[model samples]
Structures are given as structure tokens and as C-alpha cells.
Target: MKTLFSLFIALLFSMVAMAKDTDTRYYEMRIYYCHPGKLPDLLTRFRNHTTKIFERHGMTNVGYWVPVDNKDNALYYVLSYPSKEARDASWKAFGSDPEWKTVATESEKNGKIVAKVVSVFMNLTDFSPAVKAQAKNPERVFELRTYTAAPDKLNDLLSRFRNHTFKLFKKHGMTNVAYWTTIEKDGAQPKLVYILAHKSEEAGKASFEAFRKDMKWVKARDESEKNGKLTEKVESMYMTPTDFSTIK
Candidate 1:
């Protein structure tokens, strides 16, 4: 009996240690540009000054996007980190880099490139199965999805999502790793898009199975169908994180 109890205790300790090591923090940076036309300029600055600088110091760039809907006026991007400490330290160093300073100054020389920008932070919810289930196996199989809503349908679309679809997602194990919306800074149209970190392409594909069966999802679908369509339509794209990119 004594030996069996000791073995059980040791197993429990091993499980606890493993759980602690799997804690990952994903950062979703939603950068809404004020001027859509200045996007080219902003991208150049991002590549040279911001993203490149972070990569030099070690930050992972996970995904990036610009709205395909004509109603959207801003751009969006995402990054992830092993922990918030890594994020803060790497950004601190990158922010203080002399080369980055030079790039920033030069980037702005042409004009006031960005009129305004807003950022929000979010954590993967505890109930997220992708985040929780993937803890046991750290395999690279996740993809990010972004949905851009039409200008007029933005509020209604988000309402249906928050009130209806989100619960369905949880039920189906469509683990939402991070989520947020964009705020108007300059020329940006009001819009919302969210990113989900799937474990594998197959897992991501299979999520629709549960989603399709969930009664709540069906109800939500019916309600949207009744609303004569809340979104202007949706644009979706699949992406994988660049190895060693700063947005990760």
C-alpha cells in the first residue's frame, strides 16, 4: 500500500509540472490604420522598423490581415508568445533599439503616415479546448481565421456572434485563442474580426461537424437567415505563422 501511494503521488507531481510548462500566451494585435491609402507606407515601416526589429530580438509573428470588405478601412495583425514576460522583454528591447529609431524617423519623413491606431489585449479563455487539449501535445497544426463585417451590419453581426455563435463555438470545441475588434482612428470603417488557433488543419476542418450539429448554432443561423443577412458577406483566409516572425 505504501509503495502504491508513493507511485500515485509521483505521477500527480509529474502531471502538475507538465501543466505548468504548457502555459502559452497568445497576443492579438489589432492595428487599425487611420488612412487606408497610407497602408503601403505603414507596411514598409512595419517591415523595416517594427516587425523586423522585434524579430531581431526574438518575437513571433503569427498572422496578419487587411480587410477584404469594402466597408472596412483598417488593417489587422496578430502575434503570439510563450509568455507575457517574453513579449514585454522583447518589445522593450526592440523599442529601444537605435536602428529601429532610425527606421521610424525615416518612415515618417514622407508624411504623418498614420493618423491613429488602437490596440487591445486578450487571453485565450480557460474553456478553450484547443488551448487546453493542445497542452498535452505541442504540435504545430493551428490556423487563424479572420472575418470582416460590413459597415452597417457590424453591430448586429457581433451581437449574433456574442449572444449566439460564441456559445456554440465552446460547445463544439472551436477553441477561440484570441478575439477583438477595431476602432476608428482615421479612415477605418467600424468592424470586428476574431482569430481562432486550431490544433491542426484536420481539427480545424472537423470543427464544423460539431458546429453544424449544435442546436444553438442552427438557431443562430436561422435568426441570421431571417435578418436578411447581417453581414455584407464574409471573407475568410487561412494562415500559418512564419517561423521566427515577430507577430508570433
Candidate 2:
């Protein structure tokens, strides 16, 4: 009886050690811009084979999307891995897999599908909600935004969002999806990226307008800017989730 009890305790410790915190997970945001008329090929490949192959190699498919307007020649998707090292290993295995090699060769028989690929690895911030699929209540439109921090003000910007901005956004009818900081490497400035869900494009605009004018928001913004500006530039893109996207 004593030995059995000791073994149970050791097993519990092993289980605890194996459980990884969600914050330690590494996520990849990849955008693939297709050749002139090859977007269909790329989409078909991902839908039929690529996503499954990624899973076989231990990568998590978060969501996929495309722009809602013209020049919709790009695919945006995110994948999660246990860690940065795990991500590298999975990609290496995926690239060399026999099935993937065959699929890539057959798919490009028409022509090279993708013209450019942009990939950034990121980690979710401390105060951000966990990344998961949300129900499509009334079919929300998602806005992807990126901010380039001014000088040394990234932490200040993150703090403001953690404490005030996201809350006001919710109060005005915007759902904060996820927030992340791009893992800087080789002298890259780590950018802040996030997504907000809205009922519609017009609704998102109205919510932002109201949020900006609210007295509490105005005071918070003024106080944060006393030292200096938080960000030098902000970029935004509105997107609708692809039919296969788990988030939808």
C-alpha cells in the first residue's frame, strides 16, 4: 500500500511536468500571395492536404482567412506549435515528408501557385485571452491590426491595451480576439498585432468612433502620451474567415 501511494504521487508530478502553459506556445502567422490566377490552386491544396499534413507533424491550425474586397489574392493563416523549437522541427519534418513532396509537385504542375510568402512567429501577451475558436454569433467580421511602436514605448502601449483599450472596445461592441508580439530576430522591431471582431465593417467604424470620443478613453490616451507617442504607425485589414476556418 505504501509503495502504490508513492508511485501515484510520482505519476502526478510527471503529468504536471508535461502540461505546458498556453502562453509558451509559439504561433505562426503566414500570408501567402498567389500568382496572377493561381489563388484557387493554393486554396485547394491547403483545403485538401496541407492542413492535415501540418497536423500530422504536430502543428495546430488556428484559423484561415482572405480579404473581403478586391486584390484578394492572398491567404492568411495561423498555426500554433508547442514552442519555437518545436515549430522549427515540425516544419523541417513537414517539408521532407513524402506525401507533401508529392502534393507540392502535383499542385504546381500548372504553375507556381504562391508568388510570395510572409511568415512571422509570435507569442501571446500576458494579459491577452487564450486563442480559441469562437462561435459565429451573427457572423462577425474580423479586423487585423498591427502597430509599430515608437522608440521604446512598446511596453506602454501594451499596458494601455491591457488596462483600458480592450475594455472600452468591448463596451462599445467590439470583441477582442487575440493579441501578440512578433518574436523579434536579427534586428527586427517587435510589432504588436491583434484582431478585433465586429458585427460589420460599418459597425466596427462606429464602435471605434464612439470609443475614441468616450471621456474615459480620452483621459487614458492623454495620460499615456505624456512621455511620448506609443506607436509610429498603425495598419489595419478587414477579413472574413474562410469556410474551413475553425474560428468561424
Q: For residues 1-248, could you state the per-residue lDDT of candidate 1 as single tens digits?
A: 99999999999999998688553574547566646467667766666567766667876564555543424345566666666688788879987999988887887786776766766554443333332212323343334444556556666776787777777776676656555454345755545555554566577668867788878788887887674666664545444433323333
TM-score of each: 0.52, 0.89
Q: Candidate 1 has what TM-score? A: 0.52
lDDT of each: 0.60, 0.89
lDDT of 2 by residue, 1-248 (tens): 99999999999988786565446889999999998889878888988999999999999999888887739599999999998899999999999999999999999987899989999889898777889877676377899999999988899999999999989999999988899999988967789999888999899999999998999999999999998889999998999887777776
Q: Alpha-carbon error at 196 in model 2, in Å?
A: 0.9
User: CA shift at 164, candidate 2, in angstroms?
Assistant: 0.4
Best TM-score among the predictions, by candidate number: 2
Name the weakest run of 10 consecutive residues (lDDT summed) in model 2.
Answer: 15-24
List runs of model 1 lying over 4 Å from the truth. Answer: 24-28, 70-72, 80-92, 127-194, 197-248
Clashes of each: 14, 0
